[model samples]
Target: MDSLQPILNSIQKFQQQHSQILREASRVAMISNYIPDEAFRMAKATENLTRQLKIINSDSIQKAFDTISSIKLDLHLPSFPKFDYLEFDEQRLERITRHNVSVGWTLTGDMPINLYLRDEYLDMEHDEIDKIFIAFYEEDEYVQLKTLIKNVKNGLSEKWSEILDQSLDLYLEGRYKITIPALISVIEGELSSIIGSSKYGKRLVDEFHNKLDDKMKFLTIAAYSAYFFFDEHLFKSHDFTHARLPLLNRNWILHGRDDPSAWKKEDALRLLNTLSTLQFIKEIEIAEN
Candidate 1:
């Protein structure tokens, strides 16, 4: 056994060497696995960085976008579409119209208020609505009316065009009695055309308004007194036609009971504004259908 000690020591040394070789191999295998994973992670990070750089590589492009965002672009937009030209919502428009009621001018939603006036118009008082609304026609020397007639009637001598011409001529000559009734006939005819009914009186307004959405109905509310706020202002009974400034009654005007003095250029302007509003209704009807 003493003689075999050297041999045993040699065997033990060989075992230790083999174990060290196995440990080295295991470590190399682990390092090989770690190197691939670390390289893949680095490749992914580089790809993401490249993508980010591509998106914002041009400082000038980014700066141009920033500059455009800072600017306002509203020029040449005066005759913009109805929705675009209308700066206020239905509620704001109603509030604006109601502002005129203080001056004995019962402004309904039918009247096309100058929306571009914005704060200047809304902040006004003391017959300002009339000065801005009705006077524009007089100031423009009925050129506005001529344009409006063209708009409401696509072609001459069609759908109240002849009568409209007659009314305008009578109005020009100060024959308001002739003009007002003729204009009233056109208005009633326009309303009848919209409602697809023979007549538009009393409950017919409600029926006419039924075809409109809340926003579109704002136009009706803006029209005569009979729409949203039915009252004696615009549609006073024929028997009670004794009148004032805003009391331009449809029944009174139509039945020959209204004051002849009530029909003036201003009244003609208002009815024309109403015709424009009805044109809006016609547009809405076409769009919805």
Candidate 2:
């Protein structure tokens, strides 16, 4: 399993904070002599804050569980044991008062009433929870890749926005095959908008080549190299002449030439990154012109 230390450490920190807050609340209730209503209000406020932390902890656990479960189901592996969030019991404070009395030649003490509140608490197997998170992170490379796509999408123009969003949504929903083609559409649309209609493939490359001097020629070639390399690598099938090309085999996805059952998360991620890079170059070119 990949290191989930960051998330696990965060959970531990929250747990420690929760414990400290509960202890503070208990101490406040014990030492304070505020009116009954005021004390109750203060206690309730502490309880509310404690409840919010509990919710955050539970949400983190649930996200880890769901990510692991999805991977297990997809790979036909045995599922991890299901676990539930720990629920804390409600808290209440009781007020008490003490008095002393003297009789004849002797002094006596009455029962000293005690004021206290139950500490907020919940318990779980920290090791087991950590294991779940570890498993999720081990197989969760797609999430990191999706974040890359999202960052790139943030800079995209309004024309490509909807398709970029749709592609991301499809990827997250496990529709891996569909997302590849959808992302390819984003690349196609953006390039067409930049280069104008009736010009793509070799023609677009030539246009850049024609417009550059010797010094700028390498930049133009480098830009075209990225454009053609990604397109052919991710979106095209190998021809006899192009057998050495890196093949993501997205042509199968786009043309329905074969079943998309072989599509993997990495394939979609690579395509998104490739398309994002191409769009970024195109944006620069548009600005320069």
After TM-score superposition, the amount by which residue 161's alpha carbon in candidate 1 deviates from its true location, in angstroms, is: 1.4
Error of 1 at 224 (Å): 9.3
The TM-score values for the models, in the order shown, are 0.55, 0.40
Best-matching candidate per lDDT: 1
Regions of candidate 1 where Cα sits further than 4 Å from its true position: 1-90, 100-126, 155-157, 213-232, 236-245
Pairs of residues clashing in candidate 2: none
Q: Write the per-residue lDDT of candidate 1 for residues 158-270, one digit (tens) a residue.
A: 75877777766776677756666666667667777866886466555666556444444224333432243223345434455333435467776666566786555666666
In model 1, the clashing pairs are 108-222, 109-221, 109-222, 109-223, 110-222, 110-223
Query: Residue 189 in candidate 1 has what lDDT?
Result: 73
In the order shown, what is each candidate's alpha-carbon RMSD? 30.8, 27.0
Worst 10 residues of 1 by lDDT: 48-57
Q: What is the C-alpha lDDT of each candidate?
A: 0.47, 0.42
Tell me the tens digit of each residue's lDDT in model 2 across 41-155.
4433443334332222445445544443443111223444454454322121111000000000000010001101112211224233333322332346645345545655665
